[model samples]
Target: MKKRVKQPTADVPALDDDGPFAGDRQFVGALYRGLEILRCFRPTDGPLGNQELSQRCGLPKPTVSRLTYTLSKLGYLVYLEDSGKYRIGVPVLGLGYACLGGLRIRDTAQPYMDELARHAGSGVLVGLGGRDDLSMIYVACARASSVVSLQLDVGSRISLARSSMGRAYLAGADEAERTSLLQQIRAKVGEEHWPRHEEEILRAIEQVRTRGFCTNIGEWQTEVNSVAVPLRTPRHEMPALAFNCGGPAYLLSRERLEQDLGPRLAEMARKIQTFGST
Candidate 1:
């Protein structure tokens, strides 16, 4: 299994565009497989061979070969002639830049995100659920007072069902959208533990609706806790965004975070909403 210790260092995530289609009449199998191949390359996974791609994508070696060939020809995947492996290529970058350039959240939320980081002496970030991966990607960020292992930087991706940011995004999303997102998340959790996981996420969603924010305590990362609230801006596009503040669990205990920081986060979100509305 890939280690959860992986943390992003850069402000930009690895790619652009959206995730693969679920079940649609228009769903193209070839396109979905191509995307699956691209998804296989990660910051941790690095490059891959045909066999490994087959294993990760659950596709046959022959099919994988054909897809990789097509992708390589399209400049979406570059083949390493010597290593006999494939990695992401440049055209993917164009998609990411175009998507990111169209966003306004970072411009409006940045100053406040920084201030919250300083006030809480913890990392503060704003991100949205990716239409591409179902993960939330940080578009704006503020570092904590001290150096820490938590990797909440710009372009860093967080889980949809686990992180406070993710829960906030889910809570803010409309019913049809939230249901679709939850179905995707439930698949990721798998069958064995999904029942319990689903209940916990439902409670968090309720809390966000009633109490104004959500909390993450050693859920996504060990010994880390966070508070988050959903943000609603004008235009309010798909993959609705949210804000979160987090630090080591040692520094921000569960009780302290819920009692103190939680309200603060809700207030910050409201302020941002007001700021966006004007």
Candidate 2:
């Protein structure tokens, strides 16, 4: 039987002691909630109604309805008049591409991703994590085989606590930043599910810090395995890019991952960083 996927709770708390409205209460809440609603549409074709969105987000129907209407007015969402549904609009696409154009790491990482995919017969991805947050944004992706059903794609965002790509970025972050992010993740996810194995997680981070690469097996998704390394720019001391390769679990067992793929991914990160410099 397939393992049950853990669902996020409805009333997850804010990341700090100051509560949800710590900074710019009303405006920030609206902006955050609106973005959350938008993020829920990914990995699927969605033009969800108010009820569907409310259920998905565990937010009130009235709140979702208001947010949807407001987003539609702001040109971030489009209402299908005949179908009575809503979809992400042109503005979001425009802004997404605009953001992509500004990231130096994405440009440098794509060629390496292509090379990795070609050589390994697996999918490669590059992700950028928020400076003050633990979430990762998948910036670029290259795939070799169409048979694999990896849920991630370019422009996707994932929680740091649940993904190896995100954890790799976290591992490379400075001590203060890493601690703050871990605290934030714990607050958002609650203590029970936030740290799967505290000792193991810390040991992995330490190993990544030493070897400059990370590996995982069935951490994010059951029967999916991956390895990642941090990419640093010449000007910065810390990582600006996170590169990963993912494939079926059986093909990427723990022993082979540590013995073979780990070094290969680290080498790819170094090459990508060099390319970024020139």
Candidate 3:
């Protein structure tokens, strides 16, 4: 048997890839690199060293070191003495809180999400998310009263290709952005595995067009089932977000998702959009 070698993927794209802003004179590369380093830290990550940060951000180790040091000095990152690593600090939390605070939709959507979660009964979780790179990041979440509910919470990231929430977002995206995002997902998953993901996404998008929502059954997580609807905002700057209702397969059956909760969520999204406009 031969050992397998991993291929390069889009998750670690080069920092200097020329894009639409490549020729812009006002773009600050240093600031961009510093922000990229901060963005690499996930909700579940522990304090990370320069080597790990370099790998995640696709920057040279020396570059990551300088950026991390600057960030630490600015109080955006805190250095761990024993581990010789850096963790997101208090300033980052203030930024995150401020960002969330500015999103008035989270407040508007939470009550509806909670009602839907309860309507779907225990073991069901409802969430609202937006695209973050190749993943969907939960901005708000609600779970029915149950110790058995999924452990996901605000800031959790899930698959952008296989999750119902992600498919819903793709369905709502403009043609150019959708194409670009799908290509990025394919690049991240590699060519050999892309066909299956592409097929799933296409089917879900079709569902969103014909019906009001899309579903995922045993796709992202083998035992999780979900349905989602896209939420196009009145404000153009906000981009589109998505809402999902899902839980363990035993609790959320395919029939229930497609017939009951999916339609309900779609209706909720419609109401929210209408309210936002007025």
Candidate 4:
């Protein structure tokens, strides 16, 4: 057998390359690096050491150490003596809660989402879309039955390749932005597992574009099913936000989610958008 070394593809870039932001002066490298470090701490993650953070962020170990120390001192991150590692501190939660508190959409969407969730016996969520790897974050979530959905709320992150909310977002994005995000997803998930997801993601986005909504049937999680629609806010922010309705797979099967609940979600999205404009 012959040995082969796979080279990096131009489409999938290294973390340090800066890619599109190469010479954008207003883009502060240091601040971006710090935020990147903060984002590395997922709600599911345990305390992480500097070495792990360095590898995850693709930054030098020394830089990660300094950044971690600074974050710790600022109360944005905290060190654990037993673990000899750091975890997200209370201040980060304050920041996320603060942002959610001021969001006009969150306030506007809650009542409707609660009503919808009650009727559908499912979960309804509003997600903010972004170009970043964890592409969407839950801003408002309403669950009628805790037993029917996972415990996710404001600040919960979801992958762009798997969630119905993410597909709706991608369907609403411009071509260049979509391509860039797909490339980032490929780089993050790696080549071996990207193809299967890539095919399904494209198909779902196409469906979203044609039908004005999207669906996920046991894609992100085998026990989950969901449908979503993009909301065009007055601001028209890039990678505009999405609204989703989802629940336990047994209760929110593909047929039910796509056929019955999907249009309801899409309607809710429109109403929310209208509210945002007003």
Between candidates 3 and 4, name the one with more favorable lDDT.
Answer: 3
lDDT of each: 0.73, 0.69, 0.87, 0.75
> Per-residue CA lDDT of candidate 2, range 16-39, in tens?
323246665444566777887886
Quote model 2's TM-score: 0.78
Sort by TM-score, top down from the best = 3, 4, 1, 2
The candidate that achieves the highest TM-score relative to the unseen native structure: 3
Q: Which candidate, 2 or 4, has the higher lDDT?
A: 4
lDDT of 1 by residue, 120-171 (tens): 7643333333434667777667765665636656657777788888888888
Q: Clash number for every model? A: 4, 0, 0, 0
lDDT of 4 by residue, 217-249 (tens): 888888888888877766753226778877677
The predictions' CA RMSDs to the true structure, in order, are 8.4, 7.5, 6.5, 7.6
- TM-score per prediction, in order, is 0.82, 0.78, 0.90, 0.84
Give every collision pair in model 2.
none
lDDT of 4: 0.75
Q: Please report how far candidate 2 places residue 223 from its true position, in Å.
A: 1.4
Residue-level error in angstroms, candidate 2, position 2: 39
